[model samples]
Target: MVLLTLMAAVTIGIVRARNLFAVVVLSGIYSFLMASVMIVLDAVDVAMTEASVGAGMSMVLMLGVLYLTKVEEAVPSHTPWLPLFVAVGTAAVLLYGTVGLPPFGAAENIVHAHVAPRYLEQSIAETTVPNVVTSVLASYRGFDTLGETVVIFTAGFAVLLLLRGRRRSRPSDDA
Candidate 1:
């Protein structure tokens, strides 16, 4: 509950912040808080990934972009009512969608009843991996993991290309 409150506060801070740097820092804090929540939920692997990718690499990337841009966001000439309405609508829809989800950690949940047991019982024999989680991610869901890796790699490569283009477009001091 406390972690969720902190996460909500951080989210509010991020939304209310006009300073780009402060927003980035707050986003990192939010990511760290989310990682802590994941840890509390017994999702250490997810927590580690969230910390490293969300808090670590994302911060570094945003800071790099900030170095090349203004620290403060420009005030818009007009109120963003359409975007505000869209955001509220999306949130409402998402909340409505979650209403049908099984209670958290419920033993009779679909994953618990069908997926987890299969992984726990057959993981070692099928994958020769002692860790059930490892077997599930590496062997059972290898294609999914690979797809995620490809997406991340493509995004990083695109960012690098954009930064390179910006550098090339700038006038060199030595020239």
Candidate 2:
């Protein structure tokens, strides 16, 4: 709970920051903290992913972007109240929606009743894999995993294409 509170504070700091570099650093810290939270929740695989992709690769990418751009954010021209009100309104609606959800970690949840048992009992036979984790990811969820990979590749390719074509301003150019 303490760690989660710290993460929220760091997130608020990230949002309030005017220095883009400081924002990037805080974002990395948030990812690392999130990874820690995942670990505490006993989702080590997800924690490892958060650490590597969220903290590691994202920081590298953000640093590369910062190298090519200004470190400070430009001031906004309009009042922020409208956006803030909208955000609070949306959050209230979402919270109200979750009020109908079953309590967390309840063993009688639908997933525990149906999907998990099937995976444990039949995953190896259907997928012909010795490891449950391997069979689940590479066979059961294979299409979804492949889709994620392709999407990531496409996004990276698009970013490279866009960055490659960026026109740097000349020192002699005058208004």
Candidate 3:
């Protein structure tokens, strides 16, 4: 509960901050807070991922982006109320859409009866992994996880290449 509050506060801070550097730092802090929440929920694999990629690598990447750009955010030229209304409308629609979903953690959910039981029962026998998440993500969902990882790495690489190219293409003022 306290971690969730802190995350909300950090989010507000990020939104209110005009400095891009501060927003990036606060976003990293938010990721760490989310990782803590994941740990508290006993999702250690998710926590590790949030800490490593979300808090660690993402901050480093954003910081690198900061290095290549201005630290302060420019003032908006247009009024934000229209965009705010659109965002609120989207959120309301999404929330309404979720009303038909089963209550969270309900064992009666159809999907829970399927692979979850298998993961809980035979995962250890099949993968020798004591951790169900580890077995599920690394074994059962291995290809999916691998593909997602590849996509993330590829996106990061693309961002780096674009930033580097932009830098090199700029005319040197010192000349």
Q: Residue 126 error for model 2, in Å? A: 4.6
On a 0 to 100 scale, what is the lDDT of residue 31 in model 3? 97
Identify the runs in model 2 with alpha carbons over 4 angstroms from their true place. 124-131, 166-175
The order of the candidates by TM-score, greatest first, is 1, 2, 3
Cand. 3 Cα-lDDT: 0.88
Count of clashing residue pairs in every prediction: 0, 0, 0
Give candidate 1's error at residue 147 in angstroms. 2.4
- Show model 1 residue runs off by greater than 4 Å: 166-175
Q: Give the number of the best model, judged by lDDT.
A: 1
lDDT of 3 by residue, 1-175 (tens): 8999999999999989999999999999999999999999888888999999999988997887687678999999999999999999999999999999888776698877877888899988999999898888888999999998999899878866766755667744211
> In model 3, which range of ten residues has the least summed lDDT?
166-175
lDDT of 1: 0.88
Candidate 1 lDDT over 1-175, as tens digits, reads: 8999999999999989999999999999999999999999988989999999999988997897787767999888999999999999999999999999889887778877767888989987788898777888888999999998999899878867766765666745210
